[model samples]
Target: MAALAAPTWRMGTTSLFPRLFSSTQQTRFALPFFPGVTLTIPIGIQLGLPSIPSILEGIWEGILKAVPKKKTSHMKKRHRQMAGKALKDVTSLCKCPACGETKRMHHLCPHCVSSEQLLHSLQRRKAHPADIFSLAPTPNSILSASGSSSLLVHSTTESTFPLIQTIPNAHKLGCHHVCTAKGGLGNVAASVGFGGEIKIWNKSQNKNEWALDWEIPPSGDVWAVALSENEEYLACTTSDGRIQVWDLNAKQVIQTYETGARGGGSFAMSVDLSRDGKFTASGHESGAVYVFNNDAGRMVYSLSGLAKPVRAVAFSPGCKRLAAAGNAGIIALYDMQHGEHVGNLTTPNARPAWITSLDWSDTGDYILSGSLDGKVKVWDVTRGACVATHSETEGALWSVRWLPKNERALGPGMGKGEMFCAAGASRSLTFYREATGI
Candidate 1:
């Protein structure tokens, strides 16, 4: 490239002007665009920016940037190419001997089989066609709800965990939350749909079928629903932050507790009743957890500490403690009798994920928590430490619950009696048991 003529400073000029770079005075560079093709560029760098004085402005046009050279060597080039090929799984899907989920012919199922807990995957089933939003397990069966307009029931008695019943078209707008009793104790089940519709379901005594029990009228945008231990009373959370207890058998509103002085309040995200039927707890979008006295029909405590939306709250089996977790990703434990923030269980990481669900073991010795990062962690309340963490899937885990400590058959590899099932955006349910106990 040829350089432009120099701008001469006239002998009698009042102000001095810097001379423009001439063709011979310029530094030229050759840039290779392709393998052999090259383009010669004049090195005319501007002396000052636009913010500088006008005297420094008039210079040759500037070539702002140059193309970078290839830095990868022959070894690195072939390593990256082969590494990508190794990462790709086989196109064929075969049933894994360990977890029963279809995977590649020789590769392990990353969703279930892992070295850590091994996560002790027992059985994995495709529970829904869409994302599984909630999981409710009865004594002998597990009920799942998804974005699809149906509910699925799988029996936990056999090793295969077969689908026994499918409630088709159960909800028009899709169900978001489903609950069997407080602790899966009754024949009754309740589900709240995205369209603010609530449906009650009951299992037949003779047949393995689930029939519609009743429907509650939508009041103030009802969302989360929970049934009492006996299934006689149902507690539901409304968007306006009011918790209402309905007499399921009588089909009437029994007790209504207003969270705010006026009427409307924060949106309640989750609700649960104590196993003994003593206290009713609700988690709100404003990070407020309210515990109400069932007998007195009044507020017991407005718990604090969590500064973000609280997603799930669960009462211990003994009714002495309550566990609450949410967007803060830290599990807070409160004394139900005094409502004091006893402790918090946080993951050992820089940024923690939102806790989506929480459930206490039958003995109330351990608390199981599921987070948005698809991790299921069991916490020892006494030590306030995570005993075990299972990362079966990389999708958000919407729900996780202990399988009532039953005689669930061990398919191939054995595991502990205390099994917990996790489900979420993966559109499947993955069950895990304790690895050491088996």
Candidate 2:
């Protein structure tokens, strides 16, 4: 064909390929050799009797997608879904019958267990017919003072705390304060009465009864009193704001401390003698706390801070610091060495109530306080924090004292070796023991 050039071949474009196909799935092509001649072939025959390559590829892809993935364990699937949860709901709870408190089912009630501290009522007895004002614990007995004229002694060595004896008509006008000295091998107790008289008592060698040994006439009006460890000296606070130290053996005043001319001689409400007999401290109604040196026979330091009628003052067992409190509702601590106010212990967000009594633990680590609001608090001196509190009555608590550690009672289930007793307008003496042994 015109010396027909070698057969020409060309690739089909998408637009040209569509024209090559017919409605019947057949393809038509014009031959160059014959001017009007056309060639027709079945699409299946022209395309090798099979589906289009692109369609086959799509079908293969769909089949691959329909097949299942590699099998996975139920645990692995669950882990992927729930990965970040910790707490589980408690399905059961109930009310405790003993304490009327809500508690977890199958578990003991926390309130009842903690209320063991109040089990003190286990040995409760009417210590005094009237309100008990003070409690002083000896090695084996507790001496209680009340509005009555007699002093009641209870035997703590017995489980029932039976009344062992009573000092009849101990004070004609009724005693307001009673204290015992760590007074070497003998028992020496001192009592101050509203009649302005101070009496010294001695335990009888044959009867185990307290007998009046001697009496010291009031120089002025004796309001509060304390005895030295050896019972060799006595410290008393006067109505005119003077602290007088008396020689017990000599039966005379040996030293006197004055609080200056403030408020026309502030009323000395409380007085305490150091265990070493080297210092005497006093709290005054004019909000002044004074420390006096016995050897020098003069006032050494005047501590100021609680300006609201200081009522109670106490010295640490070491005689290194002083704690003073009163209607101010806070306890002020002072360094005896410098007479500087060191710190304060205050109840958080509580209305100020008069603190009536303060006592330090034998170890000097804790300070026990009783307040007019009938609350007793145990303060940790080193941490400056209240470690325990008890409010069994709404009436004022006048006195609180820590009992000497009892080695025999420190057995299993007996709580801490430490014990304390509180008394006041509630007309009862409540004993408390540490819930856990230290």
Candidate 3:
């Protein structure tokens, strides 16, 4: 510079440490920082390099970027949260006792737990146009009958509980009661109509469809019906208070049982066949429960606990116990061997809704019941107490059937979660599952 202007400096450099410019061999520049301030910064002017302010600004901007101030991304936050949760789960992993597989310590292993109870309704479908009267659960499907003349088959394993088949006008007037074998593996089904026609159905192996195998010669006395596990016998209740077991192969009534008298007994309202095919049970209008020795062709025991119309009756899978319920709103259990009154299942403040349907679980540990109040209940047989209850609508529930347990049908790595279906005035088939299942 020809004439050195006075080194007028108002403020010091922006650098917090002023000693950074102390080196005598480096060049010091008074950079403009504010209107009246100057920033003194050192620059190495070596090898024909110049101490330029723009280069210092570039370095300062680089430093600013090094002190990151960006917001955390959602993916990172999720990764951190999941990482926290995964740490907790690592502590619970243990070898399962039954299968030696990795399993949560507190949860039951699906391989060994067989008593998983069916709890809440998981799937519901409006199955029929009129009131649904009965439900018969096969291993993978459900058979439903309604006031409409159609017979509907719904698959349990499918999404949305789809209706797989519909037998149009299966009954001339309308069907009231339909039943499948007590054991889930049978291919036979029996349905009773309001017109007193009993139709036998057999599943076609090629198409997995049902066709009318035979129709019992018209008899107006038929009411509720049941099928034996072997699929060889069909048991039905009669309005005339008689229970008859038909030999399907012979197409004739092989055994006929009377309750009160030879011609007249209580109106047989409900009936069931023991899975063992050794006993037939019936509930009647006179509040009586009768058990017959199918092998002996004689009545074994005439039980008397329910003082109202006995509407529903079911036998355990092992045929060790029997359950009977009806207008009295109480479920009475009986010892099948000696026909002793074993116990009763009753709610503390149960409604006056008459129980209309009953079925036993596969392991004979629990029993399911449906009532006129549109409530379903599960009872623990050993505890003699109600374990769970569910209600969907206030319409009368006419039938409830437990879907049989089939390993192939359940698929691999699946629990033996008990399942059952209920149907009634809502004209819908409601499927339920164990609480643990998805």
Every model's TM-score: 0.74, 0.71, 0.70
Q: Residue-wise lDDT of candidate 3 within 1-438, one digit each (tens)?
A: 211222333123323435444433433444454343333444543455546786799999999889968799999999988885673434545665456777654344545444322221233446688999888888778888888889998877743456689899899789999888876575889988888989999899899999998888777579988888888888888888888988888988889887766767879988989877789999888888889999999998989788899988988888888899999999999998788998888988746678888888888888889999999888887887876677878899998888765454343334466677788999777766542232
Count clashes in each candidate, considering only residues at least 3 apart in sequence or on different chains: 0, 1, 0
- In candidate 3, stretches whose alpha carbon ends up further than 4 angstroms from where it belongs are 1-124, 406-416, 435-438
Arranged by TM-score, best first: 1, 2, 3
How high a TM-score does candidate 3 get?
Answer: 0.70
Model 1, which residues run further than 4 Å from truth?
1-70, 74-124, 412-416, 435-437
C-alpha root-mean-square deviation, each candidate:
13.4, 18.4, 17.1
lDDT of 3 at 315: 87
The list of candidate 2 runs beyond 4 A from truth reads: 1-124, 182-186, 261-264, 410-412, 435-438
Clashing pairs in 2: 1-4
Predicted structure 2: lDDT? 0.79
lDDT of 1 at 389: 75
Residue-level error in angstroms, candidate 1, position 363: 1.0
